[model samples]
Target: MRIQTILALTDFSSPAEQALERAALLAAHHQARLQLLYIAERQEAKFCDPQARLEQRARQLSRRHQLTVQALPAAGDALAALHAAAAQADLLVMDNRLHGRWRWPTRALGLLARMLRTSPCPVLVVQGAARAPYVHVLVHAAGDEDSGGRLLHGAAAMHAGATVELFHVARPRRGLGLACGEAFARALRSRRQRVQQLAQPLQSVPHTRLRVSDAFETRRNRVGLATRGLDPARQLLVQQQGTRADLLVLAHAPRGVLRDLLQAGKAWRLLAGPEPVGCDVLLMPQRGPVTARPEAAGDAPARQSAVARRWTQAT
Candidate 1:
């Protein structure tokens, strides 16, 4: 999506700081306005001036990134404030509570997953160490086709030339006592259609020397989730291990792929597993059309040139 405004929520912790840095870099990359929000607990607000602290932090980031940084400081409920602020932003960047070192009252993953389910805008969950630009992106394309496609296109815009692996798991073919041949043929046709639908967008991204390749590769595997009783999340992790991506994208909705995955708490398992994910996880909510910012008539060339130069130098 055209990210004109990015909102970042922080509690001033280490994980929050890392998320802020990522938000800043993304804001600079897209030439978008960066808004920093800090919500003070009622007790803390009574003791300290949260607005002052927020303004001070905003000024620092603005100078550091050479971009306008808006400071939004509020007291009381944090999630309530976050939801209100998110309405005006194209994307919300925040620290996944699961990554926090300290113990929290609520399960961080559950909270974040709920936010992912309800947030009006896309949310990027930053985990692990900072990687300035993601070079390898692994996308779990198990949800709606439109949502999955938008997530990929938006990612391509952010990290030009990164190798994107579109991974999906199809339900394993079940035995049909009667009409076995017809059943298999129908299943095969369905699988083929799903692959084409997911791959259609990437095929159109033009290749250029100045930018990263928009061309993406797809991997589809069949698992007998129902009959074999396999874990969808574990299976996904196994595939992700093989790809070794720098980022993982998931389009979460109540029903469909996410329901199957998250119902088993797979999202939490993926992030809080013993082995580190070793990449950033971006969770996007399924919504209407996701389009890039509409540029001025003459701005396209300049923007493209700037993006090309950045990627060229980075590479």
Candidate 2:
């Protein structure tokens, strides 16, 4: 998989700056275009000149690598500015926290999560400097043959810098104990691998790691996942040992009944305000391969439905 372009938003803080570095490295590795931007908040104008700051940051970023930076200037909400810029980007990169403030890291991550739902591209959350790009990528795709393959491709494309792993959580009809988590994972891996080749060629490469994980914990041979309804594997991105990922990519399967349920629940969870993830989520519609799905589009359809209801209510 090739990364055609990368978009990194910076607040001039250390964490944000580190995110820029990661973006630069990925862009350089893939020989893709890099766009570095800084949005100056109107109300908070210590470094208020958006154009000037953008230009300065762009120059600094360019010096660090052999690339041209696109500077964006916007008034009003800083988050809005970054969201607009992300409109044309393939992947959105930013830090989990801002510099100097010592604020909780999740504060910036929350905004990134909302932006992810609406972003046309996948979002990458860089939390401090980590040892790996992505050792194990967690996937939430479940379907027959065609339904889940598209999401797997998305995982590889977005995580071109790291190895790709396939993870699928199938809820038991009766509950949880009866399900075969390992066997299910193997089958999904076989199907997905047939659709797309792992980055490693000829044989597996130590330079990169790619494998599939089931909801079951490999350690105890027993399930770490909840028995049925609440296995985090079906919902949240839980931190796993020896399998940390620099980014998390998810493809929304609109047609699959199971995926649709999970996605709807996920949207409601985000809308209620704040989630427990420190990583960025790239929520793309399962329209097909290589097509970008932004969250703003989802809002339009939902908002239209609400308007239709209000009209019905007035009558």
> Which predicted model would earn the best TM-score?
1
Native-referenced Cα lDDT, model 2: 0.53
Task: Write candidate 2's Cα lDDT for 1-315 as tens digits.
Answer: 346878887767677777788887777666778887764322355765656876777787777777766666656666777777788777778765322142233223345435644676666667656433554555554541345355566665544435655555434422223244544544555456553443234134334445666555442223333333435433335433235554555554333334433343453232232444455444555455443223343444444454345323322
Query: Candidate 1 local accuracy as lDDT?
Result: 0.61
Candidate number with greatest lDDT: 1
Runs of candidate 2 exceeding 4 Å displacement:
40-45, 75-84, 97-110, 130-136, 143-148, 158-161, 174-209, 220-223, 226-229, 233-239, 252-315
In candidate 1 the C-alpha lDDT for residue 313 amounts to 38
